[model samples]
Target chain A: MELNKEEKAMASGELGEAVKWAINHQIKVGNFFDAKNFVSVSNVHMMIDPESVGIDGVLFLENLVGMGAKVKIPMITDPRGVDLNYYTPLGQTEEMANIERRTIKACTSMGILMTNTCVNYQTIMAPIFGEHVAYGDTGVVIYSNSVCGARSNYEGGPSALAAGLTGRTPRYGLHLEEKRIPTKKFLVKFKPEELTDWGLLGALIGKISGSYWEVPIIEGINHNPKSDELKHFGASMASYGSIPLFHMIGTTPEAKNYSSKFLNRLDDHIITLDDIISLKSQFGKKGDKIDVVVFAAPQLSIFEMQKVAELCIDKSFKVPVIICTSPQVYSDASRMKLIDQIEKTGAKVLEGTCFYNQYAREIGLANGWKRLMSNSAKIVNILGGYGYEPSLSSMENCIASAVAGEIV
Target chain B: MKTLLKCHIGIGKKVQGEVLSANDNFSARYDLDRLKGIFSRPQHKLVGKSYVDKILVLNESKGGVASAWMLYEMCARKMAPKAILFNKANTILAQGASLANLTICDRFIDGDITSLLSSGQRVTVDPMNGLVSIL
Candidate 1:
């Protein structure tokens, strides 16, 4: 909080006015209760849309580009819509369309990749396990922190860039090795045969902890889950709560080495089967049937799509179905002709857009989607934005509700 | 004591511009965007909107460079608030100036918020009624 003489002198003149003004208007980074000195950085990841645009934000993007601050590091950009040039389901105003196009062009001129897709993880810069990197994706943040054993704070665009520029983040909280240790414990009663229901488990944990960053060591569940299942559950953890980290008792890179005796905090908070069942109950009204189904608020991966495909081949749907996937996955699936077969049935394969941004609005349900089903917890949270009640269920259940057109 | 602290931060070679001002703390956990369910919400809102040509961002480096970059891009399109001013060059502002390709003049002054007191809300260093408060 102390400024040296050089900075102190600038505070009096017009020059001071500019610096003081710039720092106060950006996105909220962390709890702020524990933030220490700010580090300047470049080549950060930013998410932008008109609706969420702020006065300072508009100026910030313009100034940076004009200043040529974006020349280095790869820029991973996500546009407001499923596609860069198209309107949202509600349609973009002429002004909105014009400005967005300009913004994308400005970024690209600075050498940004301009993916314009939310699923940057599927793109070129996916972070590996234990790779300390800054990211802005809410769902991806949860996935990397919990499932991948990587390190990152819940940084938005600005902070992400700062971290990238300095290549060093504040070495406190989750960044500290001790902080990553598990504190809570849960005993699983049954082994999950199919991993689609991992989100249910995450939802149950999210309620128990009430905040992100808490570590839960899960026990029980005899089956070894695939990578996809962990990803599904991690997305749910981030969706339901702000949880950035968690661990399985017998798995995870760090946990595997410890003889299950490591502890930074005690395993005081424990969950059981009854507790998980209670989670299922929370997913819906006491007994209201589902009316529609959506999957992939974070954009599903190929592994997740394959699970759905298998389920579809064995059974038939009874309601309207929508599943979202990253463009990369869609492309690969299309090459294999999976897109043709999936759409042939009742389901629609939406590319580039996630369910969180597209579907509910297209249906004219601004903030009131009736009984919805989702395989990911993040989708459930987005549904909550519109007053749509959601049921956390398996991939099969999501498809079933989609086909049924109502919760059965 | 309202402390009005300002610092002169030198711009990176790629940065440009002067100073402008805004009223809200857009990203301190709650805002119109995050509240409205918009992902990748705009950290600053001066783009293509009605405002002075050059701006002095009275905000935080919480959004880092991208936050500043967004504002910088707006200026590059002639839609920005003009120039920028800051209390001190934190990493966020440095990145902002770098990303926006705008020249920044940073200064540091220590006084109560009342000293800079004409009118405003939620400044990075606010000396209100002669009281210095850093939010």
Candidate 2:
């Protein structure tokens, strides 16, 4: 890896211990990927939930803070693990909350913004086409790269922090022009009618594409999906496949450009109604008693919040219903009385934390929440391993099932 | 039988350890119960196996960027695998391995690593040189 003068300075500790550690880390990753040089990134988003970070990560951040580490660019955070205001009721222990506090303080000391959102592209600044950024959260990376036409690899908490401190990342993977081109193609025979359907479609494509190296181009989508629909689609795709970027013909930018430049043919798999059913068959079925219902994964957009509240109005839930939204959206949802409406249905609203990252296994054990239901395809896929028997359906169906206390 | 395998240059140090091979994909967050050091995912092939200190071999990395930080935390607790070998690795695993200083390599020139290696096999992994010797 070739380092510039500034990078050399950082590596040499002329800048600070934080920068030195950050640069060296970047170089290690860069050398592994055979990166030739560093590319300047405009924004960096780091994921630092307490469960993922644990005691060691918190201490690592504190050490960096003790070194007077400060981000060189606008550095934001993904959803936190513990919502300090609402954890105990959800069966989160004090130790988990303390870790959250320490992690937050360490990151805050480094001048990092606690955006606490995976949907930063929606509530925060959406990176423009051709923009370069270091972003954490698979959902965020995939959405920014595929929909916004920005470039980023799946920058984990450490790599994103390194990029934040240095304002650059190794120029490999999605940063290279060649890596963004489509490697696989799919044609959908059925039009997805709901957000869950969109998520199912995305997951199927992601599974078929198989890995980070394969870029999939999807076709047969003739309608412009709402931002929330695309959000679920991208989130599930990244969750299932570890896929960073995908091109939707006529929907995403550069889909045509890259396909025209690189490929003569795009004949691939054809997706149909049976394929969606086959995918759904693996999850829990109707009549399965649900212990909890959640609306999370990528924190709810304000629009999604409004929609959820509409279904939740005057409804009484037999099982616990948890709704997670970004701090930015939480405020708006509160102001609009959407949160109150959801809460009136015996639901809980958690701010600045996604369901999966929030000590999911511990909380599930504490609450005896063995069977879970959610509209987010991403969350359902994740919680299965976290000891929850997760079921997926439309938002309306999920809410109805919550009221029934079983998959309806 | 003894054999040598060549792979793409990887991260971390040279080390030899027993192998635990699975054709299934991996995710430290989604597929692991780190507290127990076992693959806790009910659907996974290696659901009950201990990953600690073995050369954990799998098909590829699944999603979840949290695996990057979780890897370091796993190592700090002394509950991490000594190394991880995959048919292919995503950016998250690569970055995680770098931060944790754990041996991780993928893209074997010979064939799929899961097919080449098996549980309880002894192997020496030279990540820097992209070589693994099965014994």
Candidate 3:
């Protein structure tokens, strides 16, 4: 891979050991993908939760800090593994919390902002069209690339951290223009009315696309979808398929720009209501008792909090209801008394942490939560692997079932 | 007789281990129980199987960024695959292998890696030269 003068300086250890290591890591990854050169990215978002990072990764971060590393551009974080204020009740150990503390201290020493969000596009600044970024979370990458018209690959924790230190990433994969063109075309025959429907549609498309390299161009949506709708759509797609970028022919920005040529060489398929129902039917028993109800995965926006709060009013749940939201939205939700309304009925609102990444397995064992029902398709897909019999439903249905202690 | 398969140059030191081949996608967060060192996802083909000290041959990387860190954490506890081999690896697996110094190679010039190697077969992986030899 060709390096610029600045990159060469970093690679040569002139900028310090951390930058040198960062540059070398980027070079290795670049060479793997046959990157021609490095592209300067505008920002970096890292996913380094304590459960994932462990002591070894924390020690690694501390080592970088000791080497005098600081981020070159704006840097942020994904949701933490342990919510410091609320971990104990949720069954997270002190050892896990300590690891989280150490990781945060190390990251802060390196100048990273504790944004603590997967919904950064919704809560933090959304990257502008054609802007390059090093973002870790799959949901964030897909949303930035498809919805915001930005460019990024699904940068993992180490790679995103490296980009934060170096301010650039390998100029391959999604950064290259040719890779963004549509490979498969889908005609949506049914218009989705709710968030879960959109999520199912995205999940179907993602499963069919099934690779990071396959880009799907979607058509046949007559109405403009809102930000929250696209958030669930992209998050579930990325979760199920590892898809980084997609185009909605008449909806998304880049799709509008390339609408004329987007369909030329693409294989066509049609998505119907029955197709989505078949996918949804794989999750739940119609009237099985549920242990818990959750609303998370791509942590809820303030608008979603409002909707959840509306459903929770004057209603009490027999099973535990967990609501995870970004701190940015949490503050606003708290101020507006949305949190109180939701919590009034025995629901707990966890700030700055998504459920699956926050030691889902241990928490399930601690709470005896075997049957989990959630509105997020992404969460349902994830929790299945973590010892939960996860069920998928709409927000309204999830709330209703939580009250009845069964899948209603 | 030794059969060698060539792939794109990959990460980590050369190592030899028993092969555990599966046609399923991988993600440390989604499909693994790191504490137990086994494939924990019930739907996965390798469910309930221990991956420790073996060459994990899988279809591709899937889901989340947590795998990048989880690989390093798993390696720290001495409970990780000896190496990972994929038909086509995504950035997360490659980046994770780089951090953990775990051997990983993909993009075989030969056909499907899962079909090329069978479970319990001893193989030597030379990541620098992208060669896997059935021993």
Candidate 4:
């Protein structure tokens, strides 16, 4: 926490200005640590709200361009930009639209490629196995740290953009070799069988981890989930908690060899099945049958969308089932005619909107939509806050709830 | 009514003063220029209602700073909120307060003002008993 005079002076700027200074000077704080510097990177993963129009959008674009010293980084987009479509569902104003259009134009013009999707890793900008990169997308941050073995912190917007510009970020915090150590242990009694269930499990881990960064090494549990399942789990953890990196003993790049960097420490907390179930009641509520099923809180990948499409079969949806996908995936689905097929199944497939931003209950209540179901614990927890009768279930259960008008 | 403004965190000196409630949440990232035609929407009508004066806001430290800057700029253009009372001087809220033109107040305490408040649009700041009686 020691600060030199310039660092101290820079810290005094307004948050934005301070961030601007930090980006410009590459000031490093002891608390904010990183490992090694990796350079000449082209692609950058970014998370920004699309609704930041006019001044907000213009200033952000201008600053981002200026900070990079006019160098462009390949930009990966987040589908749920700014959580705006959820907040203002009636449709955005011209200004809001302009903001969105201009911001995209700026990034695109600066040579920042946009997949315009949160599933950036799958769709585009899959940073190599050992690349050092700067990214601000929250879920991507967790994924890179845990899955890809790439390095980054939940570095806020300005910092992420600056890193994209300079092709360098301070080697500290989760980027440091020492900071990646596992700080907790968990015993898995029940193997989560589905992607939705994995999210619930990750939410359980996040609850136990609280606000501290922890390494979770799991024991027991016979069932081995696929990579997509783990991606869902990691994404859920990133959204529900502030965790930047986590390791599964048998899985995960850094933990595959059981490296000392991710081994258990004294500050670690041991967790069990009771811990998992405890999170269910602690983070979510036990309630009546659901009337609507919503998905894509942090935006779903194309694979998740396909899973939803497949699971909806044989399930009679009595409730409005809302499945949100990244625009890229939506476009692909439209070209492949999967969109029409899903629409025929009576499910509304929306794009560029994450459920987190929208008022489901208000819209649902207006449309006779009541009760809700989802596989995502984060969604269940957050939607519950909005008075929706949210329940956690598998994708099948959620699809069933949508078709049957009751929680399965 | 006597109102004591305190800084829960960061660099600011506490001061006891009278009350004036200028209520609004403003965002600096929002482009005011683009909002010309969109006044029909709620987010567009933020012009006059933005209370980014010299007033001090007591809120979280981290992300709150960005939002606070918007409030600060808006208020500075009009009238500053005189001063600010913070919970922590950390970047959480301090950055925003710093961006907004206002005198920083440093002090922290907890209490309830239910027994002390008699009338006039009363806003009680939780356990801090930071009571602002609008007159």
Q: Give candidate 4 regions above 4 Å deviation.
A: A1-22, A25-42, A51-69, A80-95, A221-223, A256-274, A281-291, A314-316, A358-371, A383-389, B1-135
Chain A TM-scores, per candidate, are 0.78, 0.98, 0.98, 0.79
In lDDT terms, which candidate is top?
Answer: 2
The superposed Cα distance between candidate 3 and the true structure at residue A39, in angstroms, equals 0.6
Candidate 1 chain B, run of 10 with poorest lDDT? B28-37
The predicted structure with the larger DockQ, 3 or 4, is 3
Model 1: how far is A337 from its true place, Å? 1.3
| DockQ of candidate 4, scored on C-alphas against the true complex (2 decimals) | 0.07
Model 3 Cα displacement at A89 (Å)?
Answer: 1.0
lDDT of 2 by residue, A1-408 (tens): 988888899999999999999999999999888899999999999999999999999999999999999999999999999999998899999999999999999998999999999999999999999999999999999999999999999999999999999999999999999998888989899999988899999899888888999999888899998888889999999889999999998899988786454554766789999999888877788898999999999899999999999998789989999999999999999999999998988899999999999999999999999898888889988987898888899899999998898888
Per-residue C-alpha lDDT of model 3 across residues A1-408, encoded as one tens digit per residue: 988889999999999999999999989888888899999999999999988998999999999999999999999999988889999998889998999999999999999999999999988899999999999999999999999999999889999999999999999999999999888889999989889988898899888888888888898988999999999999999988899999997788878656455476666799999999999998897899999999999899999999999999899889999999999999999999999999999899999999998989999999999999998889988888899999999999999999999999
The best candidate in terms of TM-score: 2
Q: Pick the candidate with the highest DockQ.
A: 2
Better of 1 and 2 by DockQ: 2
Recovered fraction of real interface contacts per model? 0.03, 0.88, 0.77, 0.00
What is each predicted model's overall lDDT from 0 to 1? 0.51, 0.93, 0.92, 0.51
DockQ, ranked from best to worst: 2, 3, 4, 1
Per-residue CA lDDT of model 4 for B1-135, tens digit only, reads 455423233322233333222222222332122122111113222333322322334321221112332333334344334444433222212323333323443235543222222222323232123333223
Interface root mean square deviation per prediction: 9.1, 0.6, 0.8, 8.5
